[model samples]
Target chain A: ADLQQGRAKANACAVCHGQNGLASHPEAPNLAGQPIIYVTQQLKNYKTGRRTNEIMSVIAKPLSEQDIDDLALWYSSMQVEVKMAN
Target chain B: ADLQQGRAKANACAVCHGQNGLASHPEAPNLAGQPIIYVTQQLKNYKTGRRTNEIMSVIAKPLSEQDIDDLALWYSSMQVEVKMAN
Candidate 1:
């Protein structure tokens, strides 16, 4: 699949993590540039309930492993926009 | 007294977190736009040994509460540059 597919699958994440994956909430972290391995692990955490965020768990539950890989790779490949001012 | 003072005090943070607060490492979260309260709390955590990163501890220990506040405000006020691909 392409990044488009990954982006589509990632739609559920846009609410908390902006459309481009920049985090909108103070507690939620921006997933931009996150290591693919770390991203996959966090998805696993959400899937397995090891990391407990109600919305994250709900979102992660439906994803197959392939979907997770695709999304992780897509997100990792995209550039994060400037979120904070220096 | 200004962002300049905060920036000077924040020089030590530049090694891991880039000069603009964008994290270079996969594991390190970019401190850009992080809530000032959270940033202060994390600094406090580092100082007190509640959060354990060797560098973070070294950097946090000597900071007085005012220093921490200044740094926190400075970092929070600054914009985080794009570090990852979108």
Candidate 2:
């Protein structure tokens, strides 16, 4: 359920963020396997303009806290496939 | 050297993103212990406009590839203190 709503909310995100959350965009960070707390915090930033992105701000502006929670749950639930030295 | 340089780069970031990379800003994502690749990729995104943040983009704009590498190296090298449910 959370994942489903996250996927739905992810529509705007997928353009740059990608369907798998692994961004193909050179600049976009791959969220496929990012920590939920990290993801949640970022979404909050976009909502408040702390980390202002024109598109993301608009998309995030209307999102309620529950909506943010749902999206965070959905994105963080997925496994990250990209491997780099840890 | 990398850590020092990253600390320098982190000045603009620390306002919203805490000195430790755990963001006090509701929307900003914490980067203290994010994966290097993820951090690198996100930095690249801000530089290229894929993920636009006014402050970040400006700060990121002047950063060279090596600077990006250094900052990414520094941030990912730290231990993430904020634990969330995984």
Best by DockQ: 1
On TM-score, the candidate that comes out on top is 1
lDDT of residue B36 for candidate 1: 71
DockQ of each: 0.31, 0.11
Angstrom error at residue A19, model 2 = 20
For each candidate, give its TM-score against the true structure: 0.61, 0.53
State the lDDT at A65 in candidate 2. Answer: 89
- Cα-lDDT of candidate 1: 0.70
lDDT of 2 at A31: 61
What local lDDT score does residue B27 receive in model 1, on the 0 to 100 scale?
53
Task: Residues B40-78, candidate 2: write the lDDT tens digits.
Answer: 877888899877766778888887898888888876766
Give one digit per residue, the lDDT tens place, for model 1 in B1-86.
Answer: 35667778888787777676767766556666556766787788789876566577788888898889878887778654344343
Candidate 1's docking class is acceptable
The sequence of per-residue lDDT tens digits that candidate 2 reaches over residues A1-86 is 37777778887788877776655564466565455776787889889877776577888889888888877887777643212223
